[model samples]
Structure formats: C-alpha cells, structure tokens
Target: MGRNTRKRRTPLATKAIAASAALALGGGGLIWANFYASAHESNSGQNQTKAAAGQVATISCPDVGQKLTNVPQRARRAVAKELANLDKQITEAYARLASTRQAQTRDANFVQNSIVGPLKEKRAASLDRIRLDIQRVGGRVNTSGLGSLAPCTTQPADQTNAGGGQNGNGGQQQGGDQQNGDGQQQGGGDQQQGGDAGQNIGGQAGNGPVAADFVDITKVAANVQGKPQNGGQASTGSFTTKCGVNANKNHNTDNVIVAPGVTNGAHHLHDYVGNQKVDAFATNDSLIQDQTSCQNQGDLSAYYWPVVRVQDGTQDFDQNADGGGKEGNVGKILTPVQAEIKYVGNPQSKVVAMPQFLRIITGDAKTTTNGLANANAHWSCTGFEDKVQLTEQYPICPQGSNVVRTFAFQSCWDGQNIDSANHRTHVAFADPASGACGNGFKAIPQLTMRLVYEITPPTLENGQVKNAYAVDGFPEQLHKPATDHDDFIAVFKNNLANKIANCINAGKQCQ
Candidate 1:
C-alpha cells in the first residue's frame, strides 16, 4: 500500500480561488476549500472528474462550521481586551479629577486661615503697638533742653523686638471682659476746646505738636491775591493756626473732632541723642502723654492726636477706654495712611500738601538701643529759622512752634484726676469695639483691601470720601454703629465676604 500511494497535487485554478478567499475572509477553512476546488479541476478530463468534484465538496463542507466557531471566539477575546482597557482609562481619569478637587480645597482653606485670619489679628496688634510706643516715648522728660520733643523715626524691625522694647512697656497682655449694649450709652454734646499754638489737629485732643505757619485752607481766601506766608514770618507764605473749626470740618466725615493740647502742643524743635533718657509727659494731662504729639523727626513728621467720641455716662477724649461693648470691646484703630489724609487735607488740592506717610513703630527690647534711647536721641527737631544743615534724617517742623496745651479744650481727656494706670479706663473715648469695624483695634485685612482698592480707583460713587479699608464696604459711612468697634467689624466682614465670593468664581485668584 505504501509503494502504490502517490502525492495529491493542488490545481492552479483551485489554489488561486482558495488563496483569494483566504485573503478576503481570513480563515484556514476558506484556504482549504480553494485547495479542494483546484484538486477537482485537475481531475476534470478523467472519467472520475464528476466523482472527484463531489468528494472535494464533501471534504470542505465541515470547514465552514469550524470557521464560524473560530471567528466568534477570536472576536469575543478582542472585545474583552478592549473593554478592560476602557475601564482602566476611566478609573485613572476619575482619580486625577478627585485629586485636583482636594488640592484646590486645601489651598483655599490655607489662604482663609493663614493669610486673611492672621492679617486681621496683626492689625489689632499693630494698633496696640502704635499706642504703646507712643506712650513710652511720651513718658520721657525733655532731656534735650528743647521745649518740644520729636517723633520716633527709626522703627526697629519686628524680629528684633524679642522683649517689650523698653523696660516691659511695649508688649500686649490679655485684657479683661468688656461691657455690653451700644457703647454710646450717652450721646451728649462735648464741650469744644482751642488748639495749641502750632498744632495740626488729628483727633480732638491733638497730642501731636503743631506750628502756627502751617497754613489754613479756610482762612486763606481765594480772592486774596497773595496769602500770608508763615504768619508773615519770612518769605514762605505758610499761615498756620490752631483753629478747631477748620480742623473739625476737615475730618468731620470720620465723626471725630480735633482740639488743642494733643496735636497742637507747644512746638520747640529739639534733638534726642543716643544713650539718654527723656522725662515722660505728665499723666495728669492726656494731651502731652505720647511722642505721637511730636511734630517733627528726621524726614518724617508725625501728627499724633487722641480720638474722642460718646461713651457710657461720661465723655472720653483718649482712645484707651475699653469695656464699652460685648465680646471684650474690640475697638478698631485708624491706620497711619488714613490718619495722614485726615490731617493733611486732600492730596489733589492746588495747595501744596505734605506727603501721606504712616510708619508703624514697634519693638520688644529689654535694654534701650540707639532708637529706643531718650526722646532727644530719638529725633532732632529743626525750625525754618534755625541755620542748621537740614539733614534729611532729622525731624523738622514746617512751622517753628509747638502745639499749645489749652485748658478749655472740650475733647481732651479728664486726666487731672487719672494716672497712667487708670487713665486708659477713665471713659470710653475711641472705643475699638465701636470704631471702624466692631473692635477698637485696627483690622489689617480690611485696611489692606481698602487701600488697594482706593489706590486703584480714588474716586468713588456719591460725595463720600474714602479714608481707610478699616471698614468692609466700598463706602465708609454705611454701617449703623452702636459702638465704635462696629464700624470696623462691618468693614472687615464685608471685605472677607467679597474675597470668598471672588475665590469661588475665579478659582485661585482669591489667594
């Protein structure tokens, strides 16, 4: 049987058909069927051609069923692999989205708690530092032998103040509980007083020094061709006065009045040398208590004053009064920028105006350094007549006079009976709890917002003048404050609300 067996040959025509079918259908059965067709064709001329065709057809019949099963199996495997890939891609995309959302939330929360919250707290602390530093400087005696002292210009960096700057006098302590209800229990009329000789009035009891030749806007008539200069002292046309009416009218929108004694004290420029101590101002008189009253220092001239407003049964001129409202009477303080604007008048006016600069000086040093030494060393004061080399670092009063202390001043604190320890609590004058926001201390977040906005757009709607961001809303006079602190609290709250909304709308811009 092996010797008789011959190899089966594939016909060309059948092979061509099977190869074509395989190329089109991609199945082994199709290729085999073509081969069978070719084999039947090859046997065509013989007597068994018809029988061969029948046998070839029968031989390829089973291939069709096998191809159907194999095609379906391959398709199922490919579909399963494709489905698995889709699921993995979907999972990764979802995870990435979730992570992005979480990161955004964390960032938003950090800005709110770390940046905004800390800013608010620092604003309060800064106000305290200003007041404390002023008190420390005022406590010294005029060792420089000049009638007037000078404002402190060299403010130590915050980091250097590890101790309370000078003899435990510049640190903050936990205050006691505050009073409830509107701090303005009584809204009686405060008796008006006169300004010292040459003082610029910031508050009612203007503790800051003054000069008579500083020029008065109201007194200088528009029709007058040539205005008097320095009260006709020299070639300078500066005319200064301690006019309470003009000063009051200047900062009336602030709801604060300016009087003599504080800003209008006796002005006699003197120098504070290093390594010396000056006598502290009299505690009995609130007007001359702080260096804030000093008119000149180096390139900087500070005009210090005490704010007076309604409080409880009595009236207070100094801003140290507390316990006039709930939540411990957090009184808000005005910033240096705001204060400068009120005292210096409009910057756009044709009249020559001084620069609006506010520098907050604070430190904690156990021993006195160069700047922390006596008031004489703290600053050097010069006047227009002094033939001294006008050093930019030395303090100079535009007018060569001190803001005089007057007895009849209405806004001055009743310091005749009160001492330093008790004068702060005598009466509610500038209660932080009833000031700009709702606290007496200054709120920095609100202040920053206000300043930034104003610098961008100096003009606001209506005839209202924008002073400080100490308040929240764009307009400063909207809130109905029961206490001084409410004004500032309202502003702070408004600013925060706006910031939050912006963050939500603009994604990361709020930070």
Candidate 2:
C-alpha cells in the first residue's frame, strides 16, 4: 500500500509560536512590528508595558505565521473575527491617547500615566482570554510572545527631536557626466542659478523633517492672487497633454532619493508622473531617455512630491507628533483619484522654449507651521470658484461639487539659466492683472495641474472634524490639514517646446 499522504493539521497558533521563536533566534524580522518595544524604554525602568508618569506605551506582536490550510472554514472565520476585535480595541486606545493633549510636556505625562498604562493592562487581560480561546480550539498559544508590550520614555526635546536640514544648491557631480539632449547638465556640477532668486530655502534633501524655522511662502496671502484671465488676446492655438497616474511604485520605500546622496524618499511618499524611472538618483539624461506616462510622447517632464491622505476617522496612520522614529512606519499613502494636466499661452505671443532642467516648486509642503505662505497655495470647491480659501484646512465642497487642488507654475523664465541657487530665482510668476511677463523674463508654456479627490466631507463635531482629510507631511507636522505641497521640473525638448509655442501663437487647438 502507498504511504499515507495526508497532511498534518498544524494549527495557526502553533505556527505563530514557532515563527516567534525563529525570529528571536535569527534576530531578523520585520522591525516595525516590535520597533518601539525594543528601541524605547519606560520611565519605570521596566519593559515598555509599564510607564512611570509621562511616557508613551506601546503594544506589539510578531505577525501570525503562515495560514493554516488544514483548518476548517468555520474555525478560521472565528479566529479572524477575534483578531479583528482586538485590532479595533487597540486602534480605539490610540485615538483616545491622541485626542488628550495638554501642554506638550504635561500631555506626555497624561498619556503615559492615564492612557498608555490603562491600555496596556487592558491588552494583557484580553490576551489571556484569547489564549484560553485558542487552547479550547486545540491550538497552542505563545503566552510569552503574546504578553510582550513596551513603554516609551520621553527624552529631552533637543535629544529626541528631529529636524530637516536646509538644502544648498552646490554639489560636485560624479560618474560619466555630459549635457542632456536639451543642453542641460547631465551630471557633475553645483546646482546652476537661473536668475537672482537667491538660494533655494527649505530645499532639504530627501524626505527629512522640515526645519523648525522653515517658512512656507505659499501661505502668505499677500503673495497670492486670483487666477488671471486672458491678458492680451485669445489663444491662437492650444495643445492638451494627458499624463498617466502617479508612477512611483516604491514610493513607500525609504531607499528612494529625492536629490543626489539624500535618502529622504522614505520619510514621506510622493506621487511621480512622467518619467517612469524617477528616483533619488535619476539624472537629466536618464529622465529624457526613459518612457513617459504622458500621452504626449514629446513631453518628457517629471512632477512629484509628498502625497495626501484622507482621514475618515476610522484609520490609524501612526501620525505621531515626533515624526515616528521607527523606520517604515510612516503613514499610509493615498493615490490621487483623478489628475489633469494642461498648458496655456498668450494668443499674441509665441510660448518661448523653457530652459532645460528648470526646477519649479509651486506650493510649500511645510505650510502646517507657517500659515502665511498658504496664500499662494490654491484650494477651492469645483463649482464654487468664489469660495477659494488660503487656509490649509480644505473647505467642504457644496453639494454636487468636488475638492480641487490647483497648481499653477510660474510662466516667466529667465532666458539663460535653467535653475538658480534658489529654485525660484530662475522662474517668476506672471503679473496678476495683465498676465504679463516680468522684466527680463520671457513667457514659456504655462503649466497647470488640477487634482480632484472624491473624499467624503468630514462632519464637524464640537466645532472640529475629529479626523479631517490631510496631506502627507513631515512626521513633526501632526498630519495637519494645511501641509499640502507640489513640485515640477522643466524637461521639454527644444523641438517640442517650439511646437507648443507655434501651436499657441497660431490660434490652433491641438492635442
């Protein structure tokens, strides 16, 4: 007779116990699972499960092992239901802790003493009950592993605080360097200055924390104006370009670089469109050579920045004030539900060729701290153009309308420089009234992007929406509703730029 070929009934709980042992022995596991447990100490000098006065306590567990194939369907469902309840309880605890804010120092104490301590005790009791349930089902429980919880001791502000570094435009180029097809730097050299705009302030490399002193220019109401209407004449011609959705698949990974040698991609995620191969190390030549997601094959520009997330009150994104110190623990990334790109120009004048490799940042991403700069960042309801607001808090759209994020790039460019020491000096916004180019500035094909989201309007409770929508931002930002920002780069080929110019000046609408 053939050897019995039946599979053993290995319970999921047993496998989980074995996996926990394997992880302990190898010291190679998902760090985020027990990140706070090992890295942070409680005020009590005990494990993270016990806090003294003002500390953050955390509960964590290794992931359950591989799914049990031999388990009966009904039993599996029961296990899932129990696990979900536990998760919900933990999420509620976190929300309660987040809502209780006093003075920063006092708040820490209240959280550690009142919130974390009670939650830890409650979790321990729940785990004991779960162990009994698993045992009754013929499953072995890892009591020690399930009981693991930790408390985080509060450190001094200067010691534990994280801050973003100011970005300088100067750097030496490495590797085989050459100019791109558009005569822009392919590699090696300090960041070139396009005009006299000064060094790019707040241009920190990578996804680092925003500088505490950083100011957002967009929030300044004085700097912003209503959208300009056609200035000199009607458009002679126009061309429409359709770009594909955000393309950075590994945006959640911290390994991606935003600038050379800067590993800032992982702290916050960005939505990249245009170049399919953009990363921290992408170069002008590499971008030009790569395929674009845009329908206009000739248009090869890259646009990206931190993405936004809608806070519907039920989700726990780990959006702590200290910029969650743990790696890979950044909040979730939400893709844009819809995106539109368009270029417009004056009917009387030809749209001039944009300088190669020109960098433009429209909205300030760090607007949560500096409210004045928000003036330049535009937010509005789809049908309520008259209701535009400069505040970071997104307005609830009227019935039948959608939330709109509009970004209009500076249309005037210095003829010579592609970029300046500060990214802005090379490009200046057109005059608001006449839509006329500034002195010594030539008009280029105007770039504008509108992003629409289908997020439901958050209901106001006690004069505040508990979990209103928010854009992705530095960890220290607390995911404030006002911290939206966007970036753009001009990589148009000489021929394509001329074509766009011809179409606009000729009064022809060509897609």
Candidate 3:
C-alpha cells in the first residue's frame, strides 16, 4: 500500500480466505450461534469443529481503495465516491445474502450464481467508473488488475481455530504497522483474515464478533507497557480538553475526510464531539466558523467514531433507516460516560503545532474483511488499565467495570500535506521501538482519546452470546470489534494550537 502504510509492504496480494466468516441461520431454520472459547496460548491449539454440512459462512473481496495510492490528486474525490459506491454495492448484496438463506441451502450454486456473480458484475461497473474518472483527470491506470478486484468469494466462517486463534495472537491478529503501539507488532500472515474472522461468528444474522474475537481480561497475557517506552529523551506532558461525551447527540453517517460531499457516505452511524457542524458538505471555513462543544473556545476540532450497540433484540430510532438496521447495524446506541480528548507529548522528543484543518483517520473501519493492515482497535475496560490492552478483540468486562475504547492518533506529520489521496501517507504512527517519527516527518502534539461506557456484561446462553455489544460498521465489515476506528480534523485556533505545543514541550500538564 502507499509508502507501505508504514515503510513495509506485503506484496499487494489479496487472499479472501476459504473459511473467513459465517452466516447464522441454517437448514430447517436453525440459528447458528457464536460462542467464546477457553483461552489457548499457542498457534497450534486444536480447533473444535462446528460447521454444518455445506454451509458457506460469509463472503469477502479485496480492498480496492488501499490499492488506489497512485490516483492523481485531481481524481481523488471522484474516485473516493466511486469507492464508497463499491462498498455500498457489497453491503446491499450482503443484506440480500442474509435475507435469503433457504435459497442458499436448496441450491449449492444459488449464492454463486445469483448473489456473488451479480455482485461481481455490479462491482465491475463501479470499477469502470473509477478507471474512467482517473483517465479523465489525465492519470493512467492499468485496466487489467482493476477487474480482478471485482470478484468476491465465500468462506465457511473460520470457527474455533487452534492456538492463539489465527497468527499466534488472539482473533484477528493485527498487521505490524496498524495504528499505534498497543501491543507487540505481529508480523507475517496473521494480518489478513483466514481463520480468525470465524471464531465466534454471531451477529444480526451471522455477521461477526466471533467467539475468539473476545477474551476474558483475567486470562490475557499482560501486553501493556508503562508510559514513555522511548526512555529519558521523551516529552512527558499532557493537555486535557474537556469535551462532554456527545451530550449534544450529534450523529451522522458521513466521513468528511474520506468521502466528503457524499450523503450517508459512511453507511454506519457515528457519534460526533467537538465541532457542532460537520457533515459531508462541511468545509474548512465552515468548521472554523462553527461552534464547538469543547471547554476551550479556541479548539473547534471535530472528533468522531462508530457507535457501539447492545444486540439485545432492541432497536434505536434508526432501526429501520439506512445506516442502521437495514445495513445490519441494529441496536441501541451507547453514549459514553466519559469522553476525554487530550494532546500528549512525543515519547521521543518535543512536539510542534499542527496547521489548522489537518485531518487524520486512525484505524481501519473494514478490518473484519479488509484485513488488519491499518487496524488500531485498543479495547479494554476501566479498573484493568494496567493488566492488559487488546487491539483485535473486545473485552467482556466484569460487573461494575465499564467498557473502555481508546484512540491514539498518528503524531508524526510529513510537514507538508494536511491530508493525502489515501488519507494516510502524509502522517504515520511513531515507531513502536524508538518513539521517533519517520524520515522527514516531524513530531506534533499527539492526540489521544478515551471513552468509557457503562454496559452490562454479556452472558453466554446456549452457544450464543446474549446482550453482546458490537461496533457499527459496513454490512460487509461484520460489525467486528476489529473494525473499530476514529477520525479527527484540527479546526483549532492558532492560540490554542500554540498553547498545546508549548505545554507538551515544557513538560507541564495543562487544561
């Protein structure tokens, strides 16, 4: 991917595994359930078999957007919209797949002939639009490789794999250069899905959050490290910004940084904090002029992330709407009890102020199927901060302990572009070992956030997880915790920006 997504590449090969994800309902209308497994420490653990005969779990396609790194800047917006359209096509097809189970059982090729084949055709059309859009902008693109991305395939929902799930780590082992240094950087093949996405395969209709996709905090090998792992040269101060936990209830399905000007671009709900007016149509000028929810009047920055929901047979206001139940995201939205946004110092050196309107997206929303190459999910719970941190699976916290979701944005900037065609090349995560920026990259006040939610612990019934909570995401994304992500845009006034940089460098914590 672009600049290797962090200085390395995996050879641009996309393999939609043969047993990746699953579907819920089966023959005779029985529901296939998702269940958690006993913790196993090694990658060679024996898997317990649960596949019913001839069951095709879920489908996956290669991520085309990550490959469009060479699209000219002039064609980016158009290409982005087309890419969003491609994702929508997949979501719609997946919904159709979920709704038509009996048909899938009657004829083995029914899914391939009626669903996947037609989807490939639809995707091919969208791919053509992308190619033409690039050509119209005087950007040449190979036509042959683009067609290969249009095909999708089915996997039997990789259930109960041996060892540390897949790739020697818990479910959905992350690609090394993903978001932050939340845990040990896993190398080699676990980055993409093969067996992990099928662990506990439970959801609206067998989407995901596989059993192995979760872990009991008591058993996880403590992977969290103490602060400032870069040693004595680090700048160790913080500046907390008190933005109430979205009490204003600002919500939308738009992503201004990635798919601006396209309504319902996200295809999933997002709870927004800080700048009050941000949507598909928002401009830098509009953001700068809009009111903010932050206590600091000078910081109009917008922060947002996918909403988490309890799948307890309840429905929210958007239950029947497009980004909600219709797209497989059905459940009540949980407002955070505490949403603390702050700027922290670089662990290796002093930081610099960021320019206004700087945009950054941390984590990958399509991690369930797109692979964990950009995954940055840091899931934990209150009162267990020192015990462990999980990047792939969600934590089933004990009673009285609320759930915690944290986001630490990329702190190193390219010193030029505020954003990029892929929205990532201009910024990168600090090296996990050295806490230093990449070549030519400069350190900026690192943005970090913590959200706390008081949710009742989900219990196991039969093989199903009752009251299970999952993050909102694309229908094809399976609502897995691996897809959890966040976004930000710096609309801060110069004075506040300077204050943040000064406080970080001076080694003084400020509000």
Candidate 4:
C-alpha cells in the first residue's frame, strides 16, 4: 500500500482513443462502443512494457462455478466451500503478482513459474475434492476436464475487459494489441499519500478504474428505453419497502449466498442495508430469526452490494486487513445517501409470492474477466437518468448531482428450488418482449434497487485522474466498473408476502 513499496514498476503510459466520444456519436445513444487500452512504447515506459510484453496487470482463471451446474443438493455446501477456496487461490496469486513487480521486470518467466504454477497446483487439489463431494452424493459431474480450469493466465492492463454487457447500455473490453477507438483517453491513479496525482490514474493500489472506466454523462446521448411489452392481462402495481441506507456502518467482506463458511469470500468490502445478521456464516434459519432494518418489521430481507471508495489518500479502518488494502482494495468507503428497495408486478402475469429465504444475485462480480454474459448493473447520474445508463463506465456527474446504481433482479423462478448450486439457474428474467415466464417457471414479483452516493467527482484533465473512485473488487479484477453487482435474500413474513402478491395482482401500489 506504499507508493514506493516496490520499485520495479515504471509509470503506466496509457494511450486510448477517446472511447467516450465515439460512443456518444455512434448510434441513437444506445450504441455502446468498446474501450480498448493498448500498451505502447514511450521513453518513460518502454523498458517496463518489455517485462511481460506489458505490465502483468492481474490473473484470469476460467470461472469454475459457472460450469458446475449439477452438484447435488447434498453436496452443494461442500462444493460452495471449495469454490470459495478457488477465489482465495486467485487472490493469493494476484497479491504475489502485485508485490513482485521488481522480480517480474528481471525474469520474464518468474510469474508463470513462481506464481501461476503454484496457483494451478493448489486449485487442482481443491477441484479434486469438489468432484469427490459431488460423486459422493450421486451427482453427475466432470472428473477429467475440471482440472483444466486450474491454469490461470496473466492479463495485461491494456487487454482488460471493459465493454459490451447489458445494463441500460454498453460502456466498458476484450483482447488484442491492435488499436480500436477514434479519440484520445487517459486514466486516474492515487498516490498512496494525500491522494493527489500519483503514477497513473489507474487506481489507488496501482491497478485500475482507469480513465476509460469512466465517462462524462453529458456526452452520452439519451439511451434509456423501456422493456418490450405485449398487450395482455398484467399486474402493474408495486410494493415499496423502507430500509435506511446502512447508516450504522454495517460493513463486511462476506457473501453467504455464494461462499458460505468462508471468511473474506468477497475479497472486498460490502455495504449492508437490511437483515443485520447476514454474513458468511448465516443460515436460512438464522436469517429468519435475525433482526431487521426495514421500517416494517415484517420485512427482514437481506440486501447488500460492493462498497465504493474515493482514492484520495485517506485510509479505511481495514487498510491492512485481508479483504482491504492487503488485497489491493484500498481507500475510504462512501455510504449511500439513498437506498430504494421496491418490488413490482410482472406485465404479463400475476406474480406468486416468493418463498421465504429465496436467494438472488444480479450482475456478475467478475464481469471484467467473465465477459458480458451475466453483467446487469446500470450506472447513471441523477438528472441524466434518461440520457444514459452504463454497465462498464462509471458516470461522472456534474456538481449537485450524485452517482446512481440500479439493479433490476430476475423476475421468474423455477417454481421448486429456493436456490441452486450456482446461486443462479433457479431464477430468471421474463421475456423482454412479452413478459412471459420460461416453461415451468412462475412469475414472481421483481425487486428493483437504486442506490445513490455523493463523492466529489474526480478530475480528468491533463491526461490524469485526481481523486478517482471505484467499487471494491477481487484483487485480480482490479476494480473495474463492469464488475459491479448486488445480492438479495427474501425474508418477508408469510402474511406480508401474501399481501405483496395480493397487492400486485390487484394492480394496487402499496408501501
């Protein structure tokens, strides 16, 4: 976390075509252009780029969880625990990648031999245990190819995934040493001290949230379009719940829904607004018995998301902690000014009451490497809501306006399971055109959450970002905006749940 903690790094000299301009002028405001950052030669950076052909920014491993779709229910807990271990392995490898910048510049093979190789071996061991657990429970799973996911490759800064995921529009990457945009772009970084101009505007821990990761909202054209609708009997009402925006500073780095039983599973700090007892160890029974932050005691749902930080030199309480600065996630955590939690009706059918303890995760936590497949976070500034909503680029708002993040969760359920092995698959989105649920899926009241924050906008003049802000992420993810995500657990009382269904079905909005 020190500026000169290791001197093997030369300044990151970045050259990017102004992705912001090309994106704005391209289509009817909805045209999303990819932001590609390529490493090039410059007097200050040429020697360093040769170390690994580019600074070995982070490690990219195939997402094993996305592939293990059939682990039996009896084995899910054990499988999830192993999955968390895989994330820990990646975090440890990335930490080595960041700390050994000097050694990397000396021997090009150091990374593969010293870091990646050991990582693959460790992952192979965990994967073997996972396969055994599934087999023990009579679940059909891969016994051979599963080990292939163990080998992780290093990703250069320029090749980071930045664009092309559905939110309200596209804003963030793919690979190629070739140039692809039309204008010039720069990035932001924080000097480990007073948070002024540092090495590059890449970030606080010297990884990312680069200039291309953000765009001026005023430059983006209007792109807010409604979902397709077909005439049919519809439930048009909504139910709103009042959960204060985590004023008590209920923060942690745990994710019970995904990596239960593992501490620091998230590898980044998260802000919680409801269901005070939720943590990496919380069980469904414990959740039902926990306290609530909602105004209505009947609602004890758990809602949480990654914390955003302003990289201006100040340190957080967890600066030296595991999921904090030690893992490359440093800086001050900003609390939201407003957290709007609402449930709305389906346009094509009456929504059934969601079963208590149902779990839903919207957006991909590792979208920077996972591709745009599960990316679903929408970012925009207050007054410019109708102009643009971004998935990759964080919106830079004008004075008086704060940042807004919206998550519209899946609205169709598989009718049986409350959860699945992947924490997905059991829930899904209705048809965007007709609002029809998939076969065997039942329409469920959709939850839409909007979070607002007020951090002074970072300056992006003279090719450097001062006071950059970014969401906390796994060390390897490098704080990319495309990685923003959210989680929810239904804990409503049975009577209250029925009332919600009744209200929505009757087309009556309720609070």
> At residue 369, what lDDT does model 3 achieve?
66
Question: What digit string (tens of lDDT, one per residue) describes model 1 on residues 276-303?
Answer: 1111222212212223211221111222
The model with the greatest lDDT is 4
The candidate 1 region of ten consecutive residues with least summed lDDT is 56-65
Q: Is candidate 1 or candidate 2 better by lDDT?
A: 2
Point out the higher-scoring one by TM-score: 1 or 3.
3
Global CA lDDT of candidate 4, please?
A: 0.70
lDDT, candidate 2, 1-511, per-residue tens: 1111111211432333243334323433322112111111112211111111322322222212111222232243344334434433443443343223223244436656775576667656656665666666777666686566322222222221111111110000000000010001100012111112111111111011112111122221221223445546544465677776574442432212223323443345567887566665667788778887787777787777566544321222333322221211132345666677766774234577666677766544333333222223455556543323323335455556666666666667778766542234556665544556656777777776777766555443211122234555543233333455567776665477677777877777776
lDDT of 4 by residue, 95-120 (tens): 66665666777798999999999998
Q: What is the lDDT of residue 398 in candidate 1?
A: 33
lDDT of each: 0.18, 0.42, 0.67, 0.70
Error of 3 at 406 (Å): 0.8
State TM-scores per candidate: 0.15, 0.53, 0.83, 0.85
Q: After superposition, how far is residue 312 of candidate 2 from its true place, in Å?
A: 3.2
Report the Cα lDDT for candidate 2: 0.42
Off by over 4 Å in 2: 1-236, 247-258, 313-332, 347-349, 370-375, 386-389, 480-482
After TM-score superposition, what is the CA distance of residue 382 in candidate 2 from its true location, in Å? Answer: 2.0
Model 4 segments beyond 4 Å from truth?
Answer: 1-53, 163-201
